[model samples]
Target: MTDGDDMKNGSGPAAHSGWRGGHAPRWGTAACVAAVAALLAGLPWAAHGRLPGRLATHWSGGAAPDGSMPLWAAAVFPAGIWLLIALVVSLSRRRARAGARPWRGLVLAPTGTVLVGAQASVVRANLDRTDWHEARQPVWAIVLILALTGAALAVAWRIAVHVASATPAIAPPELDLPEGERLAWFSHAANPWLQLLSAAACLVATGTLVALGVGLASPEALWPVFAVCGVIALASGVFSSVRAKVSEAGLEVAFGPLGWPARRWSPAAIESARAEQRRPSEVGGWGYRLSGHGTTVMLRAGDCLVVRPRGRRSDFAVSVDDAERGAALLNALRRRDRAGIG
Candidate 1:
């Protein structure tokens, strides 16, 4: 394919340079992934040779075994994700231009980390036990979650530092809002198309998980579904109905009735609050994204009120209309709070 075609498809010779964002090289990543896959694939046999014909993949505290996988299936499960990650990273590398943001590796870390943890968990679960009734999965779920969180935080911090440091800190124009006066702004937005997409994806995932969990899928397999479901449900709800508020309590953002995954920024905590133009694609797609700029909650790109908190790396950016007004009010509040605190 032509370089243009490769760039359009996001996979070309330039994409494999592996020099973006100070992360490991693409070849190095491929090698590491291969090593992990090999180690995981061999673990079931290396750790314990001559296992039972049918091993326990999952367990339940019940009269009968809930889930089981062929020993080979259990062994290969961890290495299996390597293929997916490699494909994605490969595509990401191909698609990216040589000088573009180094997001490809960061984006793959969470998934790769989770998959590696999963492989280790599965391998450990099936070892040294004749019984298939107890859930032997290692503490992989926590590891996976932590790994994902850590990757996100790392990427956010990198972006924050890069963007914030690069940004010139000229004093914002003053706005008149007294300390006694409660400055508050509220806005609500919903994207029907995104919500519909979420609903469809979640429905399919929920159905798949149900089948796997109940229809003899192992506990090792089912545990991750809970996490996946949580993510999907949260995304589906949050993207559809977004509520943004700026007040004395700082900047507050919530979604839907559950109102989970909410964020509140105190005036004292903010280093800078300003309006900036945001393009959704830069952050690698919308709805809770991370990129060279920072972490963003983008729903229809345009103006965003980006906040850089004190002593933190990632700048919190949310897309909203009339971002300038909100930013001005935020600065006024911050100055007021800074004065009061002093």
Candidate 2:
């Protein structure tokens, strides 16, 4: 799941892992995002003279128009949102360098554009109208838009999953544990940087919502703000901490409180384990990273244990303290499992 130009490329496990990142696939996905947004944003303009010059963009109570905008603004607002998404992606890419997940942005940008277009579609129908009840959006139109958006999201995720799974696995260096020591390894790690990032994102979302409420932005734009806040809160929960353990049973990775639904590899599942040093670019930046070669739960990125599980094309790398000891223990337990030792 990682790699870079300055990274030391060695033989026999020093550095058998790297990325197959290509710009063609990246740009293909971005184009897909923009194209979908363009098509949806064009709906009102295509309808042309049938619509009015001023549009009722929002409603109050249940049936009266409380907010309005120029027809041109209403027509192109979704496209503007699409461009804004592109700009944000560009900035993040510049900041991240090797940390950027452009593939993810491929999924996010278009899905957001679709949802924005859905809302605008209703407003387009209500143009030149003052009565909210008469201008109420058609239920069928809303339902259809939702259905399409959901389908598009599912397809995009499937594509990303395929790309991730196709990543090549790197073999870990062979090792043996200390004499007289039973096979076992355990360690816990917390990423304060990730917690701080999530907290900052949540605060920004809260600020934006406040601004929208005070009329700094369109009142109807609250849905996207709410969605952003919820996602940040969830990230705050899932990536706050990570725990890795290897024993006779297998290799287990548990994240967050109590680790209720952890990812585990049975004794028969792990192919190899090793202690390794990693760069941020190798794992595609911070907080539970994914790359063309594997997946990594990274914090500051230094010492890590890379695990290759059986029947999978990619490996797993987790940044933690005492990874050398843990990797040795893991290899020992794997040997014990093969020998059926007590």
Candidate 3:
């Protein structure tokens, strides 16, 4: 296809150049996923003679077990879940642009470690048990599993950072501003669904707090409920709306109605600015997200103002209305700043 067609369809050499991880990374990811799946699925069966007919799969706060799964189910269930997660990661990776940063390892490494650790713990607990009920909760094993999971996540994140840093940033489209002309552009975006969800969460939290205050519910149980609901409300409310502005100074993006939290990039600090179409699913579903596509403040899917900061490999994008004008203004400002510096 011609250059124009390639650019329009996002399938040209420019797009391909963004991909730098090569086949090694993809192959390694696949191998790790397969290995984890195999280990989880085979662990129980490997010790079949020593293990009971069923396994203690769940435990409450105490040493006593509260849930049980048959020998075959225990082995297959976790493996199936691992495979499903792998499938999703694969699909999302496919949807992401070529040469986008790798987020697969960050997700899979910790998940696989947790599942494998849990499967091992289950087998160790039921190794010589006569019945599933006789299996003791491996408290120490749980702690060790948590520690290992943290280590695995840390390793994965470090690897991802190295890979991202090694890849080159895509050159963003630029626009020219006329001499002696000053310009500014503004746009706003909001998701009513997120707003309503936030409101509902806030109401739930408020009701729970009131219940605790009036002695209508247990303080211990209701406090956790209040904490969860409050957190959801705060996050959803903050990301439900956004305002983007580009001017001679640079680009500024403010979040929420109060706009207490905002991000600003001076014209000099911005390498390039462009407008692009993006979706919540592309950035791993809504709000502020860090994924293969980079850091995205996704309020609603559509036009987005995307910018690459000087000396940074990843771009930052925010959903907004009239993003094309905003991006144009930012690019012009950056050019003007560059000329002044020169």
The candidate 1 region of ten consecutive residues with least summed lDDT is 1-10
Candidate 2's error at 326, in angstroms? 1.0
TM-scores for every predicted model: 0.42, 0.43, 0.48
- Candidate with top lDDT is 3
Error of 1 at 11 (Å): 58
Ten-residue region with minimum lDDT total, candidate 3:
1-10
Estimate the overall C-alpha local distance difference test score of candidate 2: 0.59
In model 2, the Cα lDDT at residue 9 comes to: 29
Per-residue lDDT of 1-342 in model 1, one digit per residue for the tens?
A: 001001112222211101111222344455556655665566565545534556665545443447877777766876776777777767777777644434554555556555545544544455555665544544545465587558755864464343222222222233356435454554444455556555445544544443342233466777587568657766765665455667778888776423446788888888998889888788888677878888888776777878999998889888766567677777888878888888
Query: Model 3 reaches what TM-score against the true structure?
Result: 0.48
Model 3's number of clashes is 1
Residue by residue across 152-229, what tens digits does model 2's lDDT show? 576556545533432323345333444444334455565665555554565456445434422334666775876778
What candidate 1 gets wrong by more than 4 Å, as runs, is 1-179, 205-231
Best by TM-score: 3
CA lDDT of every candidate: 0.58, 0.59, 0.72
| lDDT, candidate 2, at 169 | 34
Rank order (by TM-score, best first): 3, 2, 1
lDDT of 3 by residue, 1-342 (tens): 000001223322221111121353455456556766777887788778878888998988788788999999999999999999999989988998654446577888899878877887777777778998898865687898899899989877765664443333333333335566554555556666677677667656755654453334469889999999999999998897766667666787878755548899899999988889998889999888999989998877788889999999999999876577677677777767878989
